[model samples]
Target: MRVWPLLPCLSALFSAPVSAEADDASGITVTAPRLERSLEREPAALTRLEGRALAPARSGRNLGEVLEAVPGIAVTNRHNFAQGVRLSSRGFGARSAFGIRGLRLHLDGLPLTLPDGQSQVDTVDLDSVVATEVRRGPASVPYGNAAGGVVDLRTAEGFTGPDGARLALQGGSHGLRKAHLRVADADEAGAWHLAAGDLSQTGHRDQSRVDKRLARFSTTRLLAGGRELRIIAGAMDTPFAEDPGGLTRAQWEADRGAADPDAVTLDAGQRADQQDAGVIWRDPASLPGEIRARLFASRRDFEQQLPFVFPGAENRVGYQRAFHGLRLAYGDDRRWGGVPVTALVGLDADRQADDRVRFVVDEQRRVQEQTVDERQTATAAGLFARAGFGLGAASEVTLGLRLDRLRLAVDDRHAGSVDDSGSRTFTEPSGGLGITRQWGEQTLYANATTAFESPTFVELADPDGGGGMNPDLEPQRAVNREVGARGPLGDAARWELALYSVRVRNELIPFERAGRDFYENAGSTRREGVEAGLDWAPAAGWSLRAALTAADYRFVDFEDREGNDYGGNELPGLARWRGELVARRDLGPGGLALAARYQGRRFADNANEVRVGPRTVADLRAHWRRGGWRLFAAVENVADVDYPANIRVNNDAGYYFEPAPGRALRVGLAIPLR
Candidate 1:
């Protein structure tokens, strides 16, 4: 198979290091400079998770299963792998129907987000992730568009010890199964880590089945001039991932586990193959100022079948995607007017292209009509600079500015009646100012920033039977303000609290009619919230952690094209209040844990009529380890409650419910090879 040959070669290139030493790994520390800095120096709300700690969530079939208790972030899907996990952070990406939008994702410092601000989490192997870092808020200065926040996933550097391998196998209710492997080694010359996995699931819901395989390799090398080079490669292939569409209230009540009838009739689903690679070369200590450069690229082949057949309008779609980009950044320390100051400057550019076509497929999955053919592209470029100066012994102030330009173009090749070919561009400026004050172990901070989001080609090609970009569509923009504090509580506890408010212009919203999706501007919206997190250890080997988020996200001014007003309504898809509590006790080479996750009532549609929250779910996990062997067991939804895992906001016919599974059990074993 192409994957087998590809893995070992990539592993050999990265693992052939001269000599090195192994370091003990700790909690999630990220590569994003904006987040790597200490909490005392940052003004944004952020959360980090060590992959090893995400046993319950990561044990499942999708990445959404890996995000369990992070506050201000929501993840859910209808157990349909093809549609991917629908994720939203602080009410930013809740309207998405397929794929993730309104947020940014970076893997090992490489661009996972395309130039047009669309991204998917399906290709990255969660089993291989070492850490997860999420920054929740407006952030346009560090990254470009769709920076409603950032989710940076970090992979292992090299072999943990001299050289070793680990394997994990799991099986559970609903025909869930998974197998994963990790191998690594390092030396003075360089270091490398390789991981691979295969997962298959017979979902609880009818017509929900999935099969996925993935591989990842990372390597780094040292040069004589104190220079460094790191390379990363990954691949994913999915042979089958069925989509079970949403259900109406009556249908959901009748059979919570049934797939949408239309989806079953048309055999709706998708198959995909993705490959990506990235490299970073830099020298920070060799010169007075640090210099760095990065290059990355990716290719994907995909085919999808929707529920309807429009004949000339095309129902089945296939596309080939290619993307690549480069970046240059420099940073240094200097003294100005007898005061210390640090400055940073960088330039980034990227482009993405797609060869897309549409076909009408018969019941046997045979293509009958070739209704559409076209090439689509999106490009973006940006320049940015930042400065931070010491104000006093315990105070600091910082400023940053970024300028960006984005362009989208499409070429019609179907020879259809309409030209369906044109180009559009947007130039915007963004910046932020922040102040931080430190007192003993406590710190207080304030900040304000501007951000924006450009529509992706998927959005432009609205599946609501449209062939060209919606000329009425416009970019969404926002300004955010925030204040926060973080500090230690006595000698056994720690806490963090943040308050924020954001006002947006031209917020993009989705609507459904006749079984197709359409989008429009919401005119304006206001979002204000509070985030609190606490971790307490009162005694040796025992710990307690909790997080809470409360927000008022509502439309300040909104109306559909039909002149129906939708002003002053709570946001659909996100609860007004959410919280989580987890407790753990460490045993001899093992641990036991219990947790509860809760959410307040949430609207299921734009009209704020259908509510789907005010729900709570409990889970438990226990594990034992000795030497190089370990065993673990977990129970999810311990009480067997009926609840919605996700909602299809504003779906026509009120088909807004995607039910969650009842009580389930999972067990796994881990073994080591030397």
Candidate 2:
């Protein structure tokens, strides 16, 4: 084990007294107010990594891998082929497992989770992500049904420029390699823009690999006075690998710390393809008021294959989901009865369907047996309203509310009958209130919110073959209380701190019976945590960033139907503390950056029966930029450390877990023409 000095590197990078104006060439914008808006609207705590922060580190094929330094977030590398990244908000479920129990994910203002409340966000392309907005606690309500928080991803908007293209290639450790190409064009009239790209990677792990391609086109037209219409269409194809499951403590020690076990060689594969199109109309009728309406549709096909050791035991399953929705919104920044107010209101609707099939693999590498097929459909509609008012010269208050109705139905294909086909309507209500006071450059705020999440069709399905749904299951509800502050330290430094507590009732927890897993609502639980972050550009060509988050979670009066008391047990998948530190400086022409990250030890089981060891990883990145061309490279897991980001333990069998990638290097170059 080795420990490195943290101060020398930071001080050396920022010893020079550099003015903020001189760093404008790096594309780091100082929009304090815009940044504050993100903080105020987000529930818990957040960090924005964009512009140069992403450009040099965009070596990996997955966005999750590139963002591992963000506090309280971890990336679960399922294999070289399939990478499932999980975000731990303080100490919550990983991998979106708990149905976003304490977190929510949104892409381009649309919910990616299925109608069943189950969401697997494995398809987003990092190249297309322009910004990511994170909210830590259950404070996020605009998107609906999220008790944790929300992560909103904004994709790149088309540019109005001449035709241009970019090409990037990278190579790294563990047979890691990558290539990327992007092309874009804007019509002379600036009314149309088109962008397309393809990205692929050969992973460091034995079974890990990835291939993805994407395309997007958008156009805008000027309508009658002060009105414009825009349309966008996009598509993506991605395929990745899934390696064998993780091992238990006994197996790990027996194998002398090696990941290889029976050599049974069970390889999993996944293919995801999607297409989306949307249209938007905007009218700016007044200097301070605007109206916008949008309609969108998307179709996604997801397939997974589990090829096991036993002959004919291979299973190929897939699901198809289609979504369509419309939204109308009005916003105004004006004075209402001598009080300044910012108001917004909107309506939204969504329809989704899921189909799954299980197939067997034969000796001839063909699919032979077909076992089960199931289909489910869900529909939901909602209305949202938000208002912010200035209480005085330095104080402000905000209020928000949302109402939703959801219905679900399931049908079995093989039985030739609608085994569990029933529609139940649920009206979910959510609201939040916040008050902010400004002192000099810092803003102090406190808020409370109420949020609800309805059970998905999968969660409500009867495991006993009752041919009926569970009408007794109630929606999970949460009350979040938070207080925080944000401000600038001089002109070149920024910092934020937030403390939050969440109390949840009727939380859904997974239970195992007869080798099968099902969901049940536990009693009550509570989580409290503090999240703090800092960013400083203390000198020219240098930057220092760090974040630390700690959480305490426990079941409060929690029990199952069997009268098992889970109270006093640490919440599953919750880590008590996590943090990261980075120091980067310009090395004249070609620059070099170094980062050190530490992940605290955590429990692998909900019962807090097993503990995973802590890990420290160091990374180095170097790059050069000239004109429209840039070359970059990075080394991850420099010490070749081995660890598991997620683990699932079963007493009789062993551990089924996801491992992190070993030491690997990636090098690539980007060329842009304008």
Candidate 3:
């Protein structure tokens, strides 16, 4: 693979000479449960980015762009807002057609993933985030089912910023325009933050236009008895975001900027209005251990038009969702038999209700008929506990266990049709065991974990075009074993490396049928990979970061729907080699950053027939600050490299490629509103 040749060079870079600086590793702490300790004490593969480390990514608008520096992860589908961002951790979420699956997402300690094992990133405002922490590998024991990985976003406290409002405006290529307003203030007893923004863009591809509005508010109140109360709310409205759809290789070669003809013909696109709110209460000194509780609720009204036109009907799907959840947790730190021990216990319960409807559209895009209607409900609950026991001054053993139960029910309401109403229940147990040993200023860790991912409601949608779940669909499960080490290379450098192997059964896969997405399960699969990263401050005002991932993912035993054996075939929608390099230098009151991303060639289908070639793209960003005023500029695809942002696996029509945007430029200014 392409990444192998770069390993030697990367090794040399980490060991290169540098000046002395304070060790940042000792001060870093992990916030999430099951791993809440100093970075040097944790027994997992974790990555944390914040403050100066996140400045280079702040120029981009999506999480995919913000997380590019993290290894063992692949992020794409950036330009197409209708489809949202696609993220895959160790190839776990590679099959998603839109949104995120097989991973857990959290914002301010509130779950962003729905009860049915699906998540959307449109609801998250990256501009407001201050820290992003990612825990790689299967984490079912810490976060219940579908926990291939965990992504947590922590926002800045209202008191952290200046005690006044700020306004920012930006414009760029492809008719991009944006404006934002923020207000924040804090006193000894409380703090509040409010922000609003508007954005519009005429995309690079034909028929691809986007318009969106967003708002967020958060407040914290200090209570008596060492108690705290907090509230958070956010909303997003996208009136229209055109879906250009995927194109065939010939079509793409002719004009990468062209949209699929089918998409233009049907005016395919999506509209979404979503809002969510949460309240959290915490008490520390009043209890034997710290107690925390959170309640959250969200609603979304969404609709989408597909490119395909069946016999006498143009396809469209719409759904109204009501979701709510509650979480309660407690953490205690104490000593047992002269041995240091830490324990945590938590309960999570969530429910999702969706009113889904299928419609036939006319050439004018007006609803012509309603063919299907159903009310689907998913309720889930989990009880989890984890403990860490110090074996000695240099070693610690950690263990975690969780029990999860889920119930899915569909009530068909379509008149005069077969009442295909049915329900299914699942009960699963997940566990993890790990050991960590201190190695001077570095740490070495090894762990084994288990996870399961149930089919989402969208995945269960009858492939034959009906109102009930597909009887053949089943949950996918996996077991992962990993070992790794991380520590300071020198006074000015930090490095991490991890090696892991996973065995999976009933691996879910997606395919396209007449432009609509459907799901199926593969027999079994095997995955093994190496992930490594390095950060170095070679001199004053200069910093460099690099990450690489190399993996071989293949089917161990599998037969397609056509009875063709796909054993030993490589998985689709994943690159065997991925790497990134970023360098930043402070120039007086301004800073300049340059980045390059590399992806290796990979197959687009289970048969490994269609291939997407390897490509490297570069980007540049710069920012200057003076008092409360700031100026920023960014240039993406500086080399104008043409590549596909995503692929449709096993697409029957062979229209598998979704082209990414070419070179583009953006500039912005921020000024205090006070």
lDDT of each: 0.79, 0.62, 0.85
Cα misplacement distance, residue 287 of candidate 2 (Å): 10
Provide C-alpha RMSD values for all models, in order. 9.4, 6.9, 4.0
Better structure of 2 and 3 per lDDT: 3
Return the TM-score for each candidate structure.
0.92, 0.85, 0.95
Candidate 1 C-alpha lDDT tens digits along 470-589: 887888998988777667788887787777888899998888756567788889998888788887887998887788988889899999877878899887888888888888888879
The residue-by-residue lDDT of candidate 3 on 1-674, one tens digit each, is: 22334334433332333324313358888875444788867777888887777864354367866675788988888888888888889899889988899999999888989888999888777777888888888899989878999999887558797988898889999999988888888998989988888889999898789999999899999988888999999999999999998899999999998998868988888999999999999898788888989999999999998766655553898999999999998988899899988999999999999998988876676778887688999999999999999875677889999999998999989884566577878899999998777656677777889999999987887777554578888889999888788998878998999888888999998876655678888999988889999988999999988999999999999897779899999999899999998899999889999988999999999999999999998989999999989999999899898899888778888888989889999999998986
Residue range with the least summed lDDT across 10 consecutive positions in model 2: 1-10
lDDT of 2 by residue, 454-554 (tens): 77765675556566677666777888777776767888888888777777798766554332345667688777776778888889999887878777777
lDDT of 3 at 12: 39
Clashes counted in candidate 1 amount to 6
Candidate 3 regions with alpha-carbon error over 4 angstroms: 1-25, 312-314, 464-467
Error of 2 at 494 (Å): 0.4
